[model samples]
Target: MPKTCFDPAASMASAALSESTLSGPTMGTRWAVRYQAPPDFDHGALSRDLALTVESVDAQMSPWKPESGLMRLNRSEPGQWVALPADLLGVLARAVQIGALSGGAYDAAIGDLVNAWGFGAVRDAPDPAAIRRAAASHRPAHLWLDIDGERARARKRMPMTLDLCGIAKGYAVDRMAQVMDRHGVAHALAGLDGELRACGARADGRPWAVALESPQEGRRAAHGVIELVDLSVATSGDYRHWIRVGSERLAHTMDGRRAAPVRNPVASVTVLAASCMDADAWATALLVAGPGEGPALAQRMGLDALFLLRCEGRLTEIGLGRFAAHPCRARIAAATPAP
Candidate 1:
């Protein structure tokens, strides 16, 4: 179910409009779209179109596919330009922009680190040798990756592997929403994993609701609900994907500066933005920044973010921007410590 979920109450409303659900598998997870349509609406055609839209994204950006544009670019030699699809180039450009904005906290050149940590295509136990080698030779993607949007081409200036896992799913979700728009489905919600975008209000004229998951390692629970209207939400948490090492667990998300799994008190970070792509990338950047530096950065960037921290066996939350006014419902007995 990922973290974001539609409110069943609104979805189950039996109005003149009927609910149509479309779903398919992509990026090792399922994508779903729910829209309200008139009785005569062609849901079948819309479903097929939605599936194709996400498939196109997978084809261009998936690292698991050897023929994918991203993989081809990864295999290219330094200083060799590779003409890429517009969508891939756009995502790469945005990654570079966000990487610079986050002070290198968010990076797309961590493919080697992702694989070494067993979070990439080949899922195995973390390799100590690979981890050491990747850390020793790590560099931020912005410094080594070059993008020429006018030419729809990109090239690596150094030996680096590119990965788009942090933002690709959200971009796919955005593409799904665009497909719905093309089909004239105005009232809809589209999502991949925890990243979600709403085109408009539900059939009943209520804003679409998304649940925020509590960052607990062994279970799934809703920490809060956000009413979304023409907005996107993404959550990056340490609880979901991690590797256990003795008594400690290492998160899948890498801190580019450290070239290792993020080790901080921050358990999760949720961001709301106009685009799912921005929400997704910013959430990852803020999570890697942790409590010490995350809040300040979010404030400076004017991002709506909710940061959950695990302190002394209790959960603490610090909200900024819109989240500051609308705090999560789940509460612990202890007060939140200053970030």
Candidate 2:
């Protein structure tokens, strides 16, 4: 018999369950699932289902897709009640809620600003004239977007372009978790891009470990690891997607209030929440809030977040809520063992 990768005693009783992993492309990135399943299980069908799940989300919410449900609403007339898919509507509603809670720091109605800054579908260089217009015309979605849950429709009180880039990916991750549960996979890990959720403990009775990425551009290294058991975590940072303007670097994340890329010393913010959607949005919100009010907001909201701030050319980790109890230390180069 083949040896189980997990503890022998732990797996002896559940010998039918075998460790499995599945991955596919999504949102210009990739999604991965790890789980223990029966040897006879049809993993091929499950993999296809997972791919279709994420593809459905992209079809409904992708700003790059001209025929996506989100873009159709974007092209709709102001004050028009546009019909939207249930998933898109729910995500939009939640995005607005988070935007209000974050004091307009995480608005979903920044599509125009995003495009003007060359981060959206256009992907062109930032246009100064369009940037100024978008800046002057910026409005928070919470104030103008109205949702009719009963009718599965929404209307914009003012003219605005809805962008779910900040929140939809996390929602997709949540959906993937749901798909796993429906498939009767009790212990699984679902992830899209960097957003992740653990369904249960590992086969060895240990939590799934996820790496905390160091906020360094053009380099990939782990700052630490998070042991997750039935929890979700996400990180938002400027390191991954940014454009250099002379000496200034502009991140892809837009600040709706400022109508510009976030300008702060916060290198990144990682948030742990019950749902990946909340984790993803809050991460972006806190990063937009910067180090000052971000910690305060996290305290008030009782959120567990780690803010990696840039100070004197070194990384400083600020923990809130549960993170404060067990602080994660940044790994220094001097401490690394030489290869």
Candidate 3:
């Protein structure tokens, strides 16, 4: 699970500033927002509107919901055109772009693989042939997007099982931040699961502090505290979302290249990008590239990243680019974790 390092000064400032925070259910997880607003801010009404906004996104993109808009599109036959909602089309477009950029390592077209691994709404033990077929079909390039009409069509051979699990939550977080901005709140912090985005700064003009957790299963220890200002942070880890199959722990992150659960030395990958959507997507991509190569990928993509690995119960942290800007206690561990 992701952890946040609470700054003591921020705690004291929280008491000094007039802040409003709201939390609610979203995307099989939860979302929370904290901002400095007017003393008479309509907390109840604003919270309700924000929750509905997230629910709308979930209805359009959740793979767990059989009747969701994305799921409905999944049910359509190949070569059939799907009149997708604006939001759904937007996400699909971004996913396809990122997939191609990462050489298919960050594909969002892996719903069948997700289901076969028992991580989706429908779960099944994947046979060898099914796994191969699923792996071969994870090419988002096969789907053609008509942005002008907000529609998408899959080629006859490509299965249209697009899974937005990695990106939707970040989009929701971005949407929530937009909602808050529309309501005239300037400085705010928002988060969904492990995806976090910040806008402006605190009332005292300091960055928001969040705890970065060690990638040790069942251990909620904070490995470092990051100060984010007007940027988004995301951590993708095998330990957080996984299944115990007999003696093996199967992670939710499937390698698009392998068409199987990723087997990398780095236990977790945290990326800081201009938007949460980019941070979220790239983290998964770099994690698949393995610890040895992930840092290079981040540097090439111009992303700031933090990676954690366990070697004989000792945790090692590696920071690249802007991740080194902060003087956290784990400052001098050599960069990159290798298997």
TM-score of each: 0.92, 0.93, 0.86
Better structure of 2 and 3 per lDDT: 2
> Where does model 2 exceed 4 Å of error?
1-16, 326-339
Model 1: how far residue 251 lies from native, Å: 1.1
Q: Looking at model 3, report the run of 10 residues with the lowest lDDT sum.
A: 329-338
| Overall lDDT per candidate, in order of appearance | 0.88, 0.86, 0.76
Candidate 1 Cα errors over 4 Å, as ranges: 1-14, 326-339
Which residue pairs in candidate 3 have backbone atoms (N, alpha carbon, C) closer than 3 angstroms, thus clashing?
A: 4-211, 5-211
List, residue by residue over 72-119, the lDDT tens digit for candidate 3: 777877666767687877887787777777777787777788877778
Ranking by TM-score: 2, 1, 3
lDDT, candidate 2, residue 327?
36
User: lDDT by residue for model 1 over 1-339, one digit each (tens)?
Assistant: 124356666656637578888898999999999888889999889989988999999999998999999999999999999999999999999999999999998999999999988888878888999999988888799888999988889999988889999999999999999999998888999999989999988866567877788888788877778878789999998998998877988899988788888999998899999999999999999999999899999999999998989988877888887776544322222333322
In candidate 1, list every pair of residues with a backbone clash.
Answer: none
